[model samples]
Target chain A: MKQNIYDNPTFFNEYKKLRESGITYNDFIEQPAVKSAISCLEGKTVLDLGCGTGEFVRYCLENKASYVLGVDISKKMIEQAKIKTENGKADFICAPIEDINITDQKFDVIISSLAIHYIEDYDGLINKVRNLLNYDGVFIFSTEHPIVTARKEMDNWIKDGEGNKLYWALDDYHEEGKREQHWYIEGVIKYHRTISTLVNTLITNGFKIEEIQEPQSTSEGLNKMPKLVNEKRRPSFIVIKAQKSCVT
Target chain B: MKQNIYDNPTFFNEYKKLRESGITYNDFIEQPAVKSAISCLEGKTVLDLGCGTGEFVRYCLENKASYVLGVDISKKMIEQAKIKTENGKADFICAPIEDINITDQKFDVIISSLAIHYIEDYDGLINKVRNLLNYDGVFIFSTEHPIVTARKEMDNWIKDGEGNKLYWALDDYHEEGKREQHWYIEGVIKYHRTISTLVNTLITNGFKIEEIQEPQSTSEGLNKMPKLVNEKRRPSFIVIKAQKSCVT
Candidate 1:
């Protein structure tokens, strides 16, 4: 049997319902990752791949972009996105990432948020995301830092000399399209990638890295004092903003 | 007790040791923050207040800066900083933060690192740093995000959804300029300022806010899976790169 995202789709449905009912969970696009992505997006015709809930799409719309297409696989997410963006600032589409065919129309900015990790076909997803971009158009998205994934054993955390604790878990994990089956809290399917593999796949698929941001904690990390734990040890998430290279 | 900072000063000595040993701690400046700051430092005389080891001073020198001066309260740190750049790319001063009066030579860029928290007289420190800047010059620095201090509790930690497994614990007390506060650990001193406080301090001191970046994690945050308990919860740290307004 295909794994249930939760024992029932009702959970995600409920989650989406909750979000739609004036309750917003995490809008990954509103986070700093997407903010960094906006630098390359101004004045570009953008395609938001896996544009769940349309937060980023709206950002693109508000930033005076030529136009924006918010695409997602979840119909409910699309409906909620359409409802939330009642101003009709941008367009929304309900389609799997694999089915996003932008052969005719190209975009100057293409992006995704925390949504791409759910897709198992890594290269396919990247190539599809790449195909939607115009020359030098950039792709920016964020994911769980690979180090956190590599050192994911719950016991990897330890205290430092200052008696302040730290998690030195996986520093980076990347292998070409390696698959790890995940059973979400409700038994939903999830997939993960490492930094190297993800970047390599993008390079192979014709994208050049313009910038990558490793976000520390919000107001929280500083108080937590992760800086002294290990100097090079950063947080567990990275926001990557890459350009579709004309050279490539 | 005049606060013997240079006399048998342990934190100063530690900073000197770290610098003299040619150690590169992540504390002084972040790479992206450095790049962003340097972008604004071109052809300018840069002053690094609280210049821990003077790494950013060196960066300014290597970049398009006309001149660079690094000031620190620690004698040993200044000594090491001088030794590190004997080629005279920059100059260093070993003086207390408040005592360094520079009315003659104005700087185009003034910066600080994770060092300003050691200052108890936040207003005085801000004034001194501000006074050092030339008209329309900038004062850019990175500090511990204030939200980290105000919102987080010592018991707030990362855990699995079940809350049974402890992922990480936060236990650090830095009472901003009070040496040897009784935390669970021993540390020098630190002050906590929220984002608004930081902005207000800069504005009140005749500076203006240019940009603020709450860093995400490294490549790890983006590529990996098995998110940290705090990944979605808090920012790790904040990088505030501000400027001295020409009008003000």
Candidate 2:
């Protein structure tokens, strides 16, 4: 069965609160970086995997995509997305990304933002994405940086007496498997994969990596959230843009 | 002028002793990993960049490579390579890898072992290698892992009160530039680059990433050097095997 931590009431409430907050890491660091990877969306068909609340789905519609489909496992999230988005160009599907039955549909671009780490079978997902993309289509995604995901405790840091983060405490990096950690509640599951595994999986599945970014906070972001300055020390995310090459 | 720390008597002597010890990281960890990336060499022409003392050069020749050219910036290293290698199939060139004028010759395989970080212009070097490779040629190389080179200190480990390493101190990881550290002597220079930069450079240069390995210590390695167990916590090297696709 698919893990649906997003459906948990307490966790969903806390996550919704965090997303609404203007100063969250996703707001200050991830969104800008992910948006930058996206090219002109005019007339393009888009698929947003793990599309929570349809933020990117709306962005795609705003950017003039011909059509956009948002997929998420949480019924609550899909309901929220449907309530917020009223455009005919936008559609929502409440299904686990791992089991999405959208193979009949093809997309000009497929994007997933900060959601890939939640999926257990990364190779299968990549293969599915490859099949769902039209020839020369693009697959762009942002995931928690391997450095952040290498340990069981997400964002593991060594702190000083005064609680200032000294450095990231990295361990069990080579051990690739399920990592259980607590967010607002206990037992939020994510998989730890090394950078090599991430890149090699895409290459083996017929994606030609085009651009990669480990984005730092913008000046505006730093002005808004001073703690974001620490991003210079360690990246919180890794974004990759790859094109589907000739079928292998 | 290129950095030739390898020719410094103190550094050279120290390095020679470490390689001869057969219990060092290279002997127990890196060599085995690097050699595993290499395939059958029968009738293939090979080039070894930054080939120190002709180890890989001899390996290729012994495996039936038609010709092997070993290039190093250090005259002393090339001299040692010459003195140790008597095979007519092998030749040594004492020139900076950055300055080698080898556009006239192309090789079936180009291998560099743990020497890429010393070069400044990575993009230029990769372009040069691409041009010097036969179509469908393979370029396999290993370098200091980005995590190790991210800081000015080669291995910045935060240790406990009793000197037990707690975790790696990772900072300035996104900052890509020249890094100066101490080896056998002061002012040893190396370049720092993120994993994104490394992978993107290869992709942009028309090489399809075939395999990327962050190798763990073998059981044999663990028996020889117990310190190598730390490699599981964090990788010390990254080995990549990239194949040159159609010229682009």
Candidate 3:
């Protein structure tokens, strides 16, 4: 069966098995890069949206976060998260982020990894994030880059019968929204928006951007996984660190 | 005093002189492609926005349009238009499109060429076009393509002293909105939005898109102006035909 997200009970189990065999994309590339972006986790209340398999939660806990909440739209993913939890230090909830109350609690840092691209309405979610944060609180997130998302024929040209490389085709770079992507799995619908729309939405919601990053292979990553070097040609993801600034 | 739009008495006079001397960009491209997008203007009321020198109005008049309105931000352009206009067959108005009340007169065809990029808000203007159109009324417009508009450098690469080719650097393709472009005129601010944003906005505002075109040189146009061939590399303008469908 094709693995669907959020509530796929066997999803993490199969994925973990793949990672153990060194065939996983995230274990080598995105996870480590996203982990390093979290600065000063100690004594902070953190909310991790789309916390699939609770990787970031463990990172925050290892870094001594005071309290952590891992919210995932997938019930099965949250089930896996719960198995790793103890005491009241870390928590996992199975609910769509759009339905979360967020009123009874406040967070010092809010983070989502590879999640926001699924969201259809950006402005509404961003505005909601602004309202959920404390004054000067931080929000850090990562999603698929527009270039990666905008591509229709994400296929590189294959060699002909004589082993001659054909053209590497990338079309409709400017067309955005709701592209079906085939990666480790097939038929994954992802929403695309320009970097300006993403950044401008943050700015409109009173956030001061700290960093806009396109993660690439470190020399160490390249040493371990040589194929990672191809990221320099075209970025696959974008990570942004922004702060809620007090604005008039 | 620096020449301002709408009432820039010197803007068109200087620009016309440049075109006369073969020093203008659009004189060689875009204008003809845009004019041809108007399939039929016979017996239709045509409203042309930012109708500098009323060229489209004259075209529509020659094609036997019922009536035509040429509204330009530049008074000097309208003044020149007036010299060519005669007794209510054509009329010219000097006003910003945003401030103009389009409700009073419904149109069968609305065309804006090389103008919407200067306007900051696209959704509002497109919605206004919808409201001002009769059922099945068509709105055809052309603006600077987002790729050209997003360019910060706006500079072509040149050979160095040793005749080495310089970089054809195209960075910031994903960033949208305001970019300062320099061509014949210096420091001209043009707003850029991705093709998705532009098309999606039109769809969102209840206009059924008929065609989306990147206006390039025809073989005939290339013969008339050899420099027009360059449009094949990177399109300078996008022409869209959207209709306000009679839907409940």
Candidate 4:
């Protein structure tokens, strides 16, 4: 049977709680890099897939976007997005991004954060994204870095009682496919895609990559969040911005 | 101008010296794994490419093979191969594997060791190997690990004054291409290919892979060569055995 991490109630609730408490790791480390990669959102119709609590939709609205649409597979995530977003300012769809009907919609921008890794077929989804975007539209996203996702266990670091790290180890990096995590839930599947596979798939689908960054904490940002300093040892996530090709 | 590492007299001499020292890294760790991956070599016609010093060709001869052909680009390596072999037992060809004509030859086994990565066109070479082999013939080879070749410096580990290790770092692994190193000679170029690209290319070229090994020294073996224990930290080489298609 097909399953996703966001579908698990315990995992989703815990994830939503952390995001609501403003203690999310992606918010501190990855979001800023992803946000800066987006060139312009003003007066553009934006579509955010896997939009938890409509965060990107709201950000687009705040930046004076003309229209916004958010899609998520989780029912509660859409509920949260609907409650936080103003009426008529944004629209929410509670369906997997794969099943969503984008035939009548054309977007000026498409963005997803910490998503797409759950989806198995990259080539098909990329083709869909290419058709849904305007010729000039930019697609930007962040996902778990292949290095991090390759590990079956994310707890490779040796930590002391006070939570100080003593060492970190990397293994099985060349192997790719479904990886399972059991930290806060059981058998949560996350797809491990290599850098070559990920970037090559995008280029194959007629997108020209503009910028790619493996986000590291700036000195000031690190000073504020000292725990994030460990992220510099290895990239925690990958952010890429690609512009749609004018020709198929 | 066209070039291969075997073309440089200085580099080739050092490589020859190291291999003859009976203390080579590949001999200690990778060779055994690559050799054992083949099921049977007895009474088989064997073609060994990049067959420096005719080690594998000699191995085939020792195993009571009916015929063996060793091909290499280096004159000195071919000379060494001739010196070590008896008349009518094995023949040595002093030509690049890419330029050599194998159309007149059909072999039960094709083997290469710590080679093929130097040649840029893996797909072309793989196709050639397929054509040169009889149906059910197994092709066994090994190449430098992607992780080791990705580094620009080649020396990712820093050692203390006493030669104790202080740090081991990994970077630039996602990128693939030529990496220049100044080891025993000036401006030595080594071609880098990722695991995905290497294995995928072989598969695409119509070879059915049987077994793949990333050799690390076993504990008892490591104890015999304590320095080889470091090789266990990460695979230094990848060994693959693939059989020719039985059907046209």
Candidate 5:
């Protein structure tokens, strides 16, 4: 079976609490950047992979997307999403994003928010996403940056005696594979891939890269959360926008 | 004026010594990876940007390139390149790569080896390169990886009491601009650019990225130089191959 750490009760609870707090990297940095990358959603069909709690799905619907389908592995998260989203245009699937079988539908835009690192077969998923996209369609995603995922320990920062962060600890960057680490609980699995692999995999799978954003906290964001100043030292996430060629 | 540290007698002599040693990162890690990215050179017109000593220019000619032009800012380096290249098809220009004026000619393949980091205006250079390529022409170049260039100090590793490297010290990654640091001589200047900026600059300038390689040391390379094993911890260079689309 695929790793479903989000379905774990402890992880689910902690993740929900973090998101609800609204003082997260997601709220201040990643969410704004990802939202900015999406163009006009009017009349466009969207597929949201690993859509936790259907936040982006609801946002897409609010932005006038004709239809938005969200896929999540966590049944608890899907239940929460169904409860939160009352719009008829939004739909949720409680299945692993990798195993989602939507043969009858192709989307104008496919987006995933901070959920791709859980995927073990990156190329396979990319190929599947390619087939699921219409001509000239777009795919945008955000994932844990390779620098953050590089170290096996997942202890991102090295601190001095006074607990001041000295620098980000980067190692095993080229050793791409499963990295098991702790988040809210133990044995949370994530795959580590270098930036080159990420870019080349998209190109090899026939995606034309449009933009790449390593989101940095803005002045307003820093003012709201002073600790976010550390974002300048190392990016925690990488957001990419790629398009399928019309001829392809 | 553009930074011409390569013309400094002390710096040039030291750099020459390093390249001649055949044990440097350029030899073991970078050169091999950059060369591997270039395909058939037969009958191709080539441009070597920041072509210190014209090493890649000569390699292209040896691989049956019909013509090669090398541009460098350092007079001393260009003089050495002229002396080293005796082929009639090879030409040298002593000018900053950023200021090269070869509007009359278009190249089939343009390659640069470990020189782009010194350039302050990345977008202008990419735009110029796009205009300099023939339809469907390939542009391949290598530069100091953003991770290596991120820190202002350029003191890559953080070591323990016994002088063992604990981890790479990464900071100032989001800050993209000129960075002055010490090499053989003090105050060598290089520009730090995030991977996002590097990739987006090309895409914005109408280039389709073909491949991006963050070269790691192979078993043979490590066998030749044991210290090269550290390359796995972090990439020192990023080599990218991009093509000018035919329709564009």
Candidate 6:
């Protein structure tokens, strides 16, 4: 099931399998991404676009947020949320990110994590997130580093023993929205947007690049051995925290 | 650094790198496991214990859950969640799973997706989950598949070719609370529980095993590839949904 994760139960199921086996999402989501998003959340009303399972929603509530709204397209996920939460504290809605209606209520903060990559249209998604926020509201999000999407050939995307980390050539990455379909899943879609494309889209959507967070890898314990073997390596993830232009 | 996710800028920064670079939590938490978890969540009060980033919380919420409580140890994660959701609609708490004062609340559904592996004591973890649920409350969760964990030889983990796709050798399928430090992030802890450990834990905790979903690769739409190309592969993940015993 190589199809895009949304359409393919098999592909998504495989991922679920991996999680159950042993790996914890915290190991991957880590601290840097969560912390950066929290820094911008202080005393602000927030709209968590693509709020999968309300992780960030819970985060904001405990941090003294005045208001919050979490929305997602997955109805099954929302049902789970309803049972686990008290409605007086946090609200969750089921709606596609693309078709969300941003009514009169305005939010000071809007954040998404690793969820935007699944969207087929980049510009439309950014514009939608922009519409949901109040004037000068901050929008901070973290996306799958473009490098992985730009280059799908697994072999071309690994570290070698040449005393340095390796990356795939540019050609493998330039292909846009490669089609990976499966019987058990619908078409798997990924739009590989470079940092430049990402920046330009925000600007087009009236967002100013207030901050750019590039979380690099650290060599403390187990990583020291790998780093000692190959010191020159680039990190795999990036966190971008931007603000809705107060200028307008 | 562990006190709050926001305090640790590295968590966000490094996580961004991994996401951008193409390493995803999806790789570990697959779709099949999620669907299996969803199957059990119909009209149930779910507690997503150790719910990081609340993906499963959203899943339960969307599935028409009667109620949900998204809990995690990371205060910063809880704060981001507050920022993302409406207050009092769904609830979120910042507390360790062990310290959770869950006496009055008995969930119909208690779930921990890719979270429990962090608890080093498997028996204690299961007993704790059992204590939190009501009679017939389904405790459904997923973890990294045992085959994948047994294949921690590193080099042999990522194999390709052969009739079996992504074949992981089935070796030690029952190890309880095997502890290990995370590879990418420092100061994080993880535990590996085998099938026997998981099943026995459920039985010992007075929960009847309801379903064990084993997913195999299917070439539903391979252009010219034979369906036999993927078969009898070692499980990369496991989704176990068990119900609390009403009798006894």
**Most accurate candidate by TM-score:** 5
Each prediction's DockQ against the real complex = 0.03, 0.70, 0.03, 0.04, 0.89, 0.01
Tens-digit lDDT track of model 4 for A128-185: 8888999879899888877577555656554579986544444555456788877578
For every model in order, the fraction of real contacts preserved is 0.00, 0.73, 0.00, 0.00, 0.95, 0.00
> Runs in model 3 with CA error above 4 Å?
A1-14, A19-24, A156-168, B1-248
Candidate 4 residue pairs in backbone clash = none
State model 3's lDDT. Answer: 0.71
Name the candidate, 1 or 4, with the larger TM-score value. Answer: 4
Q: Order of candidates by TM-score, top first? A: 5, 2, 4, 3, 1, 6
Arrange candidates, best DockQ first.
5, 2, 4, 3, 1, 6
User: How many clashing residue pairs are found in candidate 2?
Assistant: 0
lDDT of 2 by residue, A1-248 (tens): 99999999999998998888867887778888888888789999999999999988998998999999999999999999999998699999999998987757899999999899999999999999999999999999999888888876665777899999877677778888898888888888988899888988998899977778888898888998898888877888999888898857
**Native interface contact recovery, model 5:** 0.95
| Tens-digit per-residue lDDT, A1-248, candidate 6 | 21124323565466445534533333343334546555645577978776755666777887778788887776655665566555675788888766778687878887776667767787998887877878878788776655445444322334468743333222233245653433234445555665446665776577755445434333342243333212112234556666676543
Q: Give Cα-based local distance difference scores for all models.
A: 0.59, 0.89, 0.71, 0.77, 0.91, 0.59
lDDT value, residue A42 of candidate 1:
57
Q: Candidate 4 DockQ category?
A: incorrect
Question: Highest DockQ: which candidate?
Answer: 5
* Candidate 6 interface RMSD to the true structure: 22.6
lDDT digits (tens) for residues B1-248 of candidate 5? 89999999999999999887877788878888989998899999999998999888888889999999999999999999999998699999999998888879999999888889999899999989999999999999999999999988789788899999888888888988989898899998999999999998898788988899999876777988898888889999999999997655
Model 2: how far residue B199 lies from native, Å: 1.3
Put down candidate 1 lDDT per residue, A1-248, tens digits, no spaces: 22224224566666666545532213222265467546655567978877767767777777788788888777767876898774654888777766777667888777777666666787888887777777777888876554444433323446689975553332213222333443324324445554435655776677755555554444443444534223223344556666776655
Worst 10 residues of 1 chain B by lDDT: B170-179
Model 5 residue runs over 4 Å out of place are: A246-248, B246-248
